[model samples]
Target chain A: MSKKNALQTVPCESCPLRKLDTLREFDEDELAFVKTFKHGELTIGPGAPIVMEESNSPHLYTVLQGLAFRYKTLPDGRRQILNYAMPGDLVGLQSSVFDAMNHGVEALTDMLLCVFPRDRLWSLYTKRPSLAFDVTWLAAREEQLLDEHLLTVGRRTALERVAFVIWHLYRRGRSVGLVTANKIVLPLTQQHLADTLGLSLVHTNKTLKKLRATGCIAWADRVLEIRDQDKLLEIAQMEDTEEARRPFI
Target chain B: MSKKNALQTVPCESCPLRKLDTLREFDEDELAFVKTFKHGELTIGPGAPIVMEESNSPHLYTVLQGLAFRYKTLPDGRRQILNYAMPGDLVGLQSSVFDAMNHGVEALTDMLLCVFPRDRLWSLYTKRPSLAFDVTWLAAREEQLLDEHLLTVGRRTALERVAFVIWHLYRRGRSVGLVTANKIVLPLTQQHLADTLGLSLVHTNKTLKKLRATGCIAWADRVLEIRDQDKLLEIAQMEDTEEARRPFI
Candidate 1:
């Protein structure tokens, strides 16, 4: 059964995010205001680019469903994956405010995003300051995540790096209601993993083999199955970050 | 003459940032509101830790003068320098709103900061959404810088990484009125460079030697003299990012 077929456009009045345990609840007036802000929804398939570097975009998005990752390509053509944008994450926020994007975002799965005109962000700020704070909060949260990822890539050993990225993704996926118990069906391939971890494909494979040797994880096909979550966290030398109640539009 | 001695407290009514071309101007009312928000000033010497990880601090700061770097330390005590904070940049913003900081910031030189109570941020948001937008603008800018830094560390070659970081710091310093002609007096040492670039001290030294041999740059007694800025940019495969008029407080 294809899960994509199960998706439907839910009205903003009864947005599914309001029912999620991980997200904050908006008051009736706030909810009504946000409904008017929604211009429409966008659906893109896997491997599709959403925001390209230096391209002035007219709109920003909130991930309604599925996963995506932000990356930047060097002039010489080397690419580095910055971070993932799961459901409930705001996309192209920096560009919407600062200017054109310096990076790009690509969908990892069939993704749905709530669209908003970039120019109207000012009215949201003026009329709804609390919502504006949530926007800033989201930006700060992204900065915090990028800071942690930099630490992982620059300082962690290869074994630890692979473990860290997996654990990090699993935790983030769980927060956005994308996980099912110990399993996560991620859309990334080994090449994507190599680009993200700053390791060669062969080295990334070898590191994954080492993790498999520990009998704590199993990766076959697209599903990542964690047999022992605590052991994985132990190897990663970190705990899952606690997600506070955050607003989504 | 020490520039440190020339630094004196300037009232918000006639702040010098309005005169600088790189920073945005504030209207009279906005300036008056910011004046009331100012708690006091803090002075710290080089090598002092300002915002420590996990420390609950009641105040956030705007860099009135000098430079600082944000970093994270691994459990084994390895450190990764995230990015540098220059004059007019807000420090501890993530902590002030989101929670305790996940990273630490340290002074690279004698530093002065304008402090504001964290609790008053809400009032600022409610009363002055334009200023609030400016605050979010700063956070978004920081995120953009960190994203670029992550790409450099994770994807760029060792030589390119060295060129990129130096060029980036030079451009940022020039924007905040901290540079003179083609020279930037950085307060960081080569060890700091090693930590930031994810290289050993010896490798960082070797990389510096390579850059120095190219006749594009000179580093001695803590000052970086760019003999050929264009050459450095070419090697890094990046242009110096132009700063838009940005808010100070």
Candidate 2:
């Protein structure tokens, strides 16, 4: 991509961040400082590791295109995906606090990222306290989402959990204008969804079948189409209130 | 207890956190400003809810004494404890971005809290940017801990998960000078522990027995005493890196 196109594809404008007002409130000079960031792409086939476990070097990555999964492997070789990073989603915010990553991130497709050097970002935060505040708010928001994930893994039934995950992803995609009312490009397999949800592959398959039977969602050609958005929300136990879909700061 | 005695009981002077230098960097006026905070108590007897789901309250709470857990109840009556908040820990920091809470916090003991209203805190941040930095750093540290917990729940076995939880609690207690090297007080019961770890009660019980049999921990009088910290860490697959223990800023 040309430099101009690369800058346009940075996904910053479309990010549904809760604290965009704070970011936009930045002075021209401050915005210019952030605008200096460069972007890059990594052409990795399926199953290529994007970030390794216990690595000292860390870089903040914002997805420009394609999919990636953050996961860790147990001693017995079982893997659990922490989450999936999609377009406009930023990763490595936690790595900013820690010196090393405890888990690994692997690309499930050829990926593109707007990469920021960790030290430079830290320097920016030191010079621009407002940026630091924005970053902190973003991390706090991530924590809130993790809290919800803990609930899904701990209490929700396999079907409810799966429904919840799908609904969450759909809502997030919709917020970024990546999805319509009923259609979303899921791009994740039953196994990938299973790993993310902490469920067995068979269980994930069964849950998807159940949802399909109920006309809550349909799966074909690597896309998930929500057949009944209202019913899906009810199954996920999500409120129609603004609170349920509020953007994280 | 007298105010002075209560402050003494907190052992602020002896805290490793005091050696972190962040607080020491504060000027006299800043120190005096924070010292002016009045200590208070929040009592919610066992099973009393502290923060309810879908309720909007703009306050951040610092635990003064006692234990509390954040949880969400499912439609089928299943509950998952998202986290256990201890003394000196923060609760509801992320809720400031939202108009309502998606999860509920309830006391395991009659809880005591140092409540900071969000508006007042934000005003303070505007005036004393450095204090805001410190508070944001503290919130970031909590996010790091939550990330580690996510790894444990997503990847580790039931036995390893329980062991890691206990080990983490022990380490946190040590950081706060609440425990010695080998002895620690565990205030939560196995059932409560099970809920937090996303394990069945029977599975949690079996795991505890296994740990006891391995001579890594001893459970008596509702307390878990670590006999071999190294062995416990090994079983938990935890890295003993300084970064893991440090309060990240």
Candidate 3:
């Protein structure tokens, strides 16, 4: 990913994510600290590598726009997509905290990120208790997602797995206004969905077709439409875990 | 689980976990705050529930000794073991931060836990930046483990899946002196292993037998003997990821 050097800084007061209804509001002083905390903005195109596994970047990021995924590759070159990063999600806490990245991240769509230096994160903790709590909240929220995904990949049937992933993306997408009227432009290939589901390409295709035939979902040209959210949840045996108010940095 | 309420406080300065070489040392002031932060001790027998899914407890815990696992269950009564908790691993942090527990935790053996009030966690962060950093580090570390397990359960062959779990447990067990001479009195059943590997009981048993025949491992009664660490890692395609110095709170 190449950096766009001409800086068009978006001031904290005018930050787009802060305007989302689902996110909690930051107080004046907290927003002031965050304004200083942000290093700059980063822009990258679809499918560009954002962070490599086993390496640390000096910066952490918050997704200002677009989709990305965190993944890992086995020795045989098989990849497992761990989870997705959406608008307002923090992208690199593991690498920033431990000084070694255990997974790689790549842009799934044309993206913009607000960058923060890793070292200054400590100062945020010492100076702002509420924001520090928010940082831990984000990390804990991530763990909760991983725990749910592990359950899905490890025990759910093929049909159930496919349904769950779509249901999750739908809700997260709705929260950030990326989706509306049961539809979103999900920047993902069927192969990417296959990798995320732990299913082979042919099997994932069959499962997707089965769901579409049931009129629960439809996919074409990278757009995902949840035709029947209730039917999808029934197959997935899952419901919304989204909090009315969510935190983001 | 029954609470044995007679007071037997293990003071923070003389805490057993603090003496471990693998853990970083806390300073006098930090130690003083921890001593006050800790409410008391908790003891539970084997097979006891430590925390329940979808419910939040007022207190959070650290495993001072013994083994436990974090897991989730499907509506059909099928289960998936997400990951294990060892000495020095923080438990219930997700619930503490988010006020919702997404997974249940159970004791694999007789366990001793250090209890801290959930409300007090915020004070720790506000008062002590280093300890707050440790809290984030612990959370990040847990996420790292989940990422690795997702890769293993999602993509590894049955044999590799079995090897990876055993190798991972072996290394973590060794860290706190729970394992010795390549053997540990493991407190898990074949069904538990099956749940962990996301394989059927019969398939899991067959894979275990195959590994046994290769002289890489031996499991009789409740004892697990890793006869060949290198051979096991080769099959698992995993190596030790333990940091030379780690943090615990």
Candidate 4:
């Protein structure tokens, strides 16, 4: 099946998560209990706001297809992308900490999302502590990602930062079976990449040009294709650990 | 007893942690069981390395006196200070994830630390699941701090970043009863401050000079004193929230 069709096949009752090894730790009854959760799909077009700032809506979302970026806008209208979410990844996990979101989430492309109500999730956690633990673990992982991003923003060079991001996206794609060898398609704009890296648009474009000039990567048709994976990885200064790779698969 | 004298009174058998309200959530037997494990204290001098990189010694430490910086150094000798640990704070909680430290921790002053072996702590967790949950919660709290730091590094200016650091240190000091109404002492050096903020030493000094000129804060002789906290808070762009303050108290 095509990627789009495969994602559409994902339903609340027949979610592939039930068969995943990560959920194998849950017993038959626990699985059935979670399966009872209500699910709804949200399709967000490019540049559309998925979760608005200060919105008290308490639905937790999981990315089913396409990509989304979470960001906060400054008073001057500049944006800072806090994180990027991909398929099978959970977003809005921190919403549990507050009554409303302090940041906004926007779809980077036409996307699909599976959402669950916070109240129902809390009730499920109360009955199955293991599920709660899993949720907490997911939050912890997000925290780790934030820490790594801090290091990148604070210390890495512009080229290194861009390479790190591309390497990261490539690794995530590889794990989700969207990548073949070192080549992967990245559907992000230079402006969005700059926001995520905390760099200016001009600097981001310059860095990408350098990467392409050095025969490191190719960017065309809004898709990024890594050419020299080893050279790019070295420039990115990424630690080749299993944990650094995506966890979805 | 004065705070300094309180430091010398090492009543391992009667540590206040046994009576802490958070631990009270555990049963009496569990408290006694945890207390039976001997606590060892280690003193580290300024610039002394406390934890080595990539060495997997499994022991969790609690700061009893003085200060330390958690950092990861790159091959080129660029260091990023992840966070600072003060009295009553737990360090090395990430040791649960591996056998060796991915980062190195060093003493910023002559420091005293209370050590708990990983095996003993793991045993305690097995016996009391609540204890494990509490540790996880602490880890989660650490993650939140990292997230805030990420935001600081990603978007905030050099001056704003320093102000945020000072504000955070002052708030932490107040939470642990180390601060009075309007004054707090910061134990970090400008050089260390630069490392933490990912700025050059000269830039950090320039920022400090600016804050000093504005009479927002004062730093000398390794002590940072907040002069006008309201102004500093405003400059730091800190949100006034109960959750931003420590919840343990």
Candidate 5:
């Protein structure tokens, strides 16, 4: 990981993500405090650990660019990817609040992150409940995502689990402008899909091939193109998330 | 369903759960605000719906007594239980923060809930950052629980999942004074376990029977007795949660 103070680079006042129509707007007071709350920027290459399991970091992070994922490993080295992180998604919140990271985070792509000191996180709550609420809001959103993930893993058929993940990722990507012309750079290996879907690598491979045979989705060279969104959603047996302006830290 | 003004029964000033060693102590001012935030008391019998899936409720709730579980159903009626709500757990947090209950909450036993009108939720944030932080803390803790739940469902084998759930519940129940003499009255049916472990009823029965053959646990008539906690943990391959004074709303 490499880091330098991000003060000179795009200030929080002009942060591009804040301009997105999908995010709730922050008032000047909230924006000003957030600007000060930011410690600096850190950039890391793909496949680097952003946070370690059961450790503490001095900072909290918001993904300003690129994709990352949070995961936990078993004693035997089996891993389960909890969810992915993207721009506007705050990482290390468990560390910021409790000073411990219960799970590990790793970048899926070269990433830019806005960092905030954990020491002052309390002050943000005390001074601006609105922003504090945003923090809670973000946490609640993460919990909701996990609920969806649990459902897919626990109850869905293997094929349904694969379909739900792709559809879910597509919706998340499109909301963040990462999708273009029905395609997005997935940046995931079949092994990652296996970890995410709770399936064996061989099972994931066969399932993906079966889904591909239907021609609803095309995955090649890390690019996933949705050939038929309706068909994909139908097989996933899920609805797209409600289109609402979401809060972020 | 039943409703009565909790003000006349047990005010937030004397909330029993707040006095437990497992919960953090609140300042006088925070306690005072919580007293007003308490709208009333709600009581329901077993098999009651505390909150509905995809619906909105006017109030947020804290489980003051009894056990409840949150769940979501697939389009075909298959249910996946997300987690259980116990004492000090804010039940309607999704509703409290966003005015939406994305999952259904149901009582597994007679339940007592401390009500907080959702409309005043923001005012609490504005008035007390400490309390706001507590709310966020609770949300983060919930997220952590879900992460663990996801891991068990996604990675563990059938017998391992059953053992983990039992061990996990024992620890949670023990911490909250619900366990006695290595046993707790687990108000769960076999079907609930089936839903929770993502296994079929026949599979759940067989797995429980297999675990039982090891002489580590006994289940009869809604009561689960742990004959060997250490052996169960060994099979589950999970460490107990770090005993800490958790915050709550």
Candidate 6:
């Protein structure tokens, strides 16, 4: 499928993410430049490839709707999910800088992405330091999440891993308005969980069953509901850091 | 202990890392700007911290010499070593961008770090898009390494984890001129390995014994020697990617 869209549509000032307190605001000139810089938006269906690995694309993206994930595959076809991309999360920033994607991004649900030209990124960096810094902040936030995931996969027990990942997703989803009250929809399967948590499918189901038995979480109809958020955090042994206002561009 | 150093002694043009093929070279103008932007150098002894979690330091760092590791600690004292920093590695880019360090960096050996003012980072972004791009590149590289570590931790078998980490360190060290032929000084203890690999000390020792029995590796006297590099890579099921010239700052 063609990754490029026909034309620019969304004006930066009225962008949906501007209403969220979670993201930092852009000044007038910055917004105008971004509006011009944004080429268009592209939508993909579930299980669609947004950015393929090893293919050099001259564009970067930001998630405008739905969910997707970044992942890598071994030579023997073993896949590992790196992290999920939610609304307002910048996609392909690493690829834009490094000039090659070491991993690929695939949509979990139907996804809409804001497209920006990779060639103009240098202009953004030179003319808009705040925006450039925001990009760095986003990359750093991603790195922090990966560090946490690495620890969870490497050190945490099976039960703790399940609890921790659920809590992590819940918090991030809530921050981005994907979660309302105690419920959030996750377009993931047992296979996704197994790959993400580094467990066998059987083990993932068993651990998830154990978590369900605690009455702290309910997962059904692709929606996960937190019945006892405190208990889950306690089980996970995690304290959420107070994240500052992040930038979405 | 203080994480501060007294004065700036080295000029940017005379920076030792510029001599290495591993790092990208800066033009004269960029070099002059960086020399003025740099605040000073700090010497940290083994086991001392370079950046502490939650502390707002006004400076970023680049490793000039020796080794260090970044990590996070649980409230109950569980520690997970995220990744190592060798010569020519940018140390505090994440923290400088995000404002609060989500993890801590500690020296694995006596180390020297070139300190740069965090406030002037915007200057680099505005005046030197290339350097700003390089900073993002460094952060992206770090994220990529973390991705690999996550996959190793979450998916690889115990023996594979052991084999992979050793190969990882050996390759990274070689790129930065820290390795000589088959030998590399790690400056890490068994406990460090246990923490880093998410294994117990006993398990770590046993795994090392198994690796040594294969006639592919030797670890003793704080130094690791590779015996058959190809055999180790085969055991790890890995291929080393050819890394391009990296930016040290």
By DockQ, the best candidate is 5
Q: lDDT tens digits, residues A1-249, model 2?
A: 355546554344443342323223445555566656433444566777778877754577766667788777776677777767766566776565566766788887777766766666656555565566566566676677788887787767788788888887776666555676568776788888888788889989988899889987888998889888789888888654332332221
In model 6, what is the error at residue A219, expressed in angstroms? 1.3
Leading candidate by lDDT = 3
Over B58-86, each residue of candidate 3 has an lDDT whose tens digit, in order, gives 88899998899999998888899999999
Instruction: Choose 1 or 6, whichever is better by DockQ.
Output: 1
Global Cα lDDT for candidate 5: 0.88
Model 5 CA deviation exceeding 4 Å by range: A1-8, B1-7
Clash pairs (backbone) in predicted model 6: none
Residues A152-194, candidate 3: write the lDDT tens digits.
9999999999999998888889989988788999988889998
Residue A77's lDDT within candidate 6 is 76
What ranking of all candidate models by lDDT puts the best one first? 3, 5, 1, 6, 4, 2
Model 4 off-target regions past 4 Å? A1-14, A17-30, A36-43, A54-57, A98-101, A119-133, A244-249, B1-45, B62-66, B98-101, B110-133, B242-249
Q: Give the TM-score between model 2's chain B and the true chain B.
A: 0.81
**How well does model 3 score by local distance difference test?**
0.89
The Cα error of candidate 4 at residue A51, in Å, is: 3.8
In candidate 5, position B238 carries an lDDT of: 84
Model 6 accuracy (lDDT, Cα): 0.85
Task: Please provide, for model 5 over B1-249, each residue's C-alpha lDDT reduced to its tens digit, 9 standing for 90 to 100.
Answer: 125452447777777797678888888898888877788888899999999998999989988899999999998999999999989898888877776778999999998898888889999989988888888888998898899889999999999999999987888888788888888989998899989989999999999999999999998987889998788988998876655788876
The complex in candidate 1 yields a DockQ of 0.79
Query: How would the docking of model 2 be graded?
Result: acceptable
**Position B236, candidate 5: lDDT:** 91
Q: Alpha carbon lDDT of residue B98, candidate 4? A: 44
Q: In model 2, what is the error at residue B184, expressed in angstroms?
A: 1.3
TM-score of each: 0.95, 0.82, 0.97, 0.82, 0.97, 0.95
TM-score of 1: 0.95
lDDT for each residue of candidate 1 in B1-249, tens digit (9 for 90 to 100): 133323436777665556678888888788889987887778999999998977877889988788899999988899999999888889999887777898999998998888788999999999989899999999999998988888888998889889998999888888877789789898788899989988888999999999999999998998998899899999998986688878778
Docking verdict class for candidate 6: medium
lDDT of 4 by residue, B131-153 (tens): 44455556656655776676677
Q: Please, what's the RMSD in Å of model 3?
A: 2.4
